[model samples]
Target: MSEAVAPRAAIIRRLSITRFRGIGNLIWRPGSGVNLILGGGDVGKTTVLDAIGLILSPVNPSTLSDTDYFGRDIESGFEIEAVIALPVDSAISAQVRPAWPWAWDGKDAVVPALDGDSGEPVYRLKVRGTEDLELIYEVLQPDGSTGNLPVMLRRSIGLVRLSGDDRNDRDLRLVQGSALDRLLSDKGLRSRLASELAEAEVKDALGDAAKKALADLDNTFSERSLPVGLDLSITGGQGASIASLVGLTADRNGIPLPLASWGAGTRRLAALAIAEQRQGDRPVTIVDEVERGLEPYRQHALVEKLQDSGAQVFVTTHSPDAIAAASKASLWYVDYTGQIGPLDTNKVARHRANDPNAFLARVTIVAEGLTEVGFASILLRRALGAPLSQFGVHISNGGGHEYTLELLEALNSGGLSFGGFADDENGKHPTRWKALEDVLGPLLFRWPKGCLEENVFGATPEGKLEALMADTLGDRTGMRRQTLALRLGLDAKTFPELATAAGDRLRPTMLDAALGTVPAGREEDKGAYKSHGGTWFKSLSGGRELAGKVFTLGLWPSLKPQLLPFCNSVRSAVGLPSIEDLPQ
Candidate 1:
């Protein structure tokens, strides 16, 4: 028989939060891969993750305690609101509103106003001193209206609140128990027996032995079908049984193993395995300080594992290694203002200059935001007719100045060339311009003659060439002003403008120019002209014409013999196919 396939876990498709403590309402679309939430402590990173859990699984009134894990009085009232992605069969779209039960004068009395529906049947719990909590549980009807809330939420709020901390609790065991465990328990058997008894119209047709046999059969079937084993072991003196699922297990040294007992990396690996096993079918897995308590090597392993798990993993870390391990697209930097924005990979590359590994190669363009990177790449590819990846470009979504600097340093150290692009920000200070020049040298190109930031796609193609030539040739003697000007079709006066216009376009053109290939032509004024009875040499005197032609008649013949080999070398360094087959 074919092996049974495990059911695919439900992914978190959407997370919406409204007015949960410090955070004003916000929605996040976490990627399927590890979503690293980089931020300082107390920036609502954990709160946002907790809100997700609370929305799906609210704390039960019976489970509430005066002194909770954080040691704060378990206030009788708290509000949590969120919309989670539910399984396809889930009655609700996974919307949840959980709150502490309200009591007035030590008597249980339902709040009358809470009984009224805003649109659908709204469940409300009014805790006297706290904000009124309302849960709108509705299902999409065939006629486009909302149906009733799920019976599970009405019966027990704990069904929605899958508390991470409560997973180890015994009374809370009902919530954390695996499907197999639920199938083995007396409760599950009793429920099954009750259903059968009701169906057969018999009070106790199924005896205890029959129930036990059914439970055993279910457990055996479940165990046979699972990809991994689950074992429970009681730790001596703690009165707590630790469950080992998947391939994880405590070392032979025993519980409370010494820090030195296992390799430094083992803890991170163990934690990662535990997280993956516990994640199950849940959508979001929030890990606090993923980089904390992990050594550098272990951190990389953890990042790889998280990425491989294909779950939405949110991690906060101060470690550069953790940031480096995260893909440029996956990284987010939390600012001092508590706003989380993506990191510019280029900026990150520049920030950690001392560490070579901090910089990433493979042409991943890092931009400050998703829109900028998306639009810019579209514009560049449309204008250039070449894949941006061909040029080793990556766009990083950076939060601010600090992130920008970090990216630049990281990239610079990694021996990658990157151009920084940012918004004009109401046309105030040129932030991107300053960032590029400070790290890469001076601003070689600016848009509209240093007015707006340089239009990266529109900049002349020769700038990258010029920068390369300047760096490689090391002197103006071989790359003479007049000769170079002729190659680029510019007089000395227009040379600066042309050079500034080159931008990234310069690199490829420089390679070609160095190999004795003529540069493309553009139109410019030949001489003074008169229009409609105007004087000669008028401002618009010059008619449309070729600005300048790259003089190759004698140039190629003179330079090819000496420059061909060098051109081939430059091409190889940049990972481009050789130009040896092309005509000199």
Candidate 2:
């Protein structure tokens, strides 16, 4: 017969916040592997994490003070509540069964509840405060009854929180609850260490490499020019010396190096390593900005570790790596506004995977391609004096015209404002183009000509285009700019029917072939072709820089027919008030 596994500690079954900080009321149900949180700054991301930590803590911890209150309003109260569920077959389960008899039928491991299962012997932490500053941390006890426990006597319920390094060298950060201290507190390790003080025992207990490695550190520090003047040593499992009971330190040319001496990224990884080992039976862990300071390689490894850690992990991040690391069903999206929910479907996941910052924005602007992205970004900054972030707008690359049309359709069907910019290439397919226009209406902005390249060159004042080409493209300009103009003129007239009835026919290759005559063998002047304004513009990864160059010369006037409609449509779609709507 197989041996029976012992039941593990409790996990946070569900979390709810009411009148807490900026969150008027919110409920979050997390996934078992990794609970992903998405949002931009000051959207109450940190507030949610802090509330979880605060409610789990004992009532009236000195850390709890006036600022803990959501706001100055005395009339409304603040409350944070969480359901902590213990395994039905665990040691604590038997004791609580008599008092709290409800049994959970679903698997009680790390995975989330599918239908919000209301299990029993489960405890609730209802931490509430009033206008008079009165506060209480009340939890339901095992006896199917409620109790207001004292701060020191409160239950732990296996809650762990990891904050980013913004807190700086605080000895026992919420990140790990003193990882070094937990290791030292281990009675078994302490007992073994007590028996060993020298070579014979140290080698036997720690293996040859670890024992020799520590000895080598001591010898190296004794001989080198020292900065801290302290020899490197490992902390023993005793209370005798504080550093000895704390953790490891090594020497770099006689300078003692502690974990704190490492770079931010290393420090983060190191801290997590310590926390994982020292975590004991804790089943729930919360990490903020899980990708902060981690390199691409480290991000992958760290994500794997988090997924396999067995503990229920909840993380908030804004990194493409982080998004791709977890499944869509596991991810949740939140904005600075009150909205919070899951991605829930694979399609939502794919969309978010393409743009990690999309879920974090208040309003999403789906741009047709890289050029359009650059152009839209530039326009927003020029008009708003800041990035679109100033107006709660975020730009997502639509990948292509078809993708833009699809994304706009999704946004419209979902009743979201359909904000998009597309190339004129799609206009050739009248049926699909009309359908897309119906969905996006005035919110869709199509360049009047070929693409951004055609629109930008066609709208620019004559001499300024040449001046820009000369200044920006330098030596490569003379041939390229002239050819770029010729290509634009060729596309000036449109075909009533697309030859192939697809976007490909709209590309330069096809149009360049049909545009009457040209300069002989210009193909040999390929260097110039690469530098042509339209070709050069298409090569750029960002349009904001180009926007600056053009506007600085006062080349493209603000009211150019091509520029106005695009700007107005995008503004309306993103909920930015027109100039007339501004306060007088």
Highest-scoring model, TM-score: 2
TM-score (all chains, Cα) for each model: 0.37, 0.59
Q: How accurate locally, in lDDT, is each candidate?
A: 0.39, 0.57
Candidate 1 structure quality by residue, lDDT tens digits, 210-291:
6566567668868788532322222223222222111223457467443223543454444344334433333345555656
Scored by lDDT, the top model is 2
lDDT of 2 by residue, 24-83 (tens): 878766665677777666677778887776776522444345566657555677888776
Candidate 2 lDDT trough over 10 residues, lowest sum: 493-502
Question: Model 1 lDDT vs. the true structure?
Answer: 0.39
Q: What lDDT score is found at residue 320 in candidate 1?
A: 71
Q: Model 2, which residues run further than 4 Å from truth?
A: 1-9, 58-60, 63-66, 89-123, 140-146, 149-155, 166-275, 278-280, 292-296, 318-329, 344-364, 387-394, 405-419, 423-578, 581-584
Model 1 C-alpha RMSD to native: 21.3
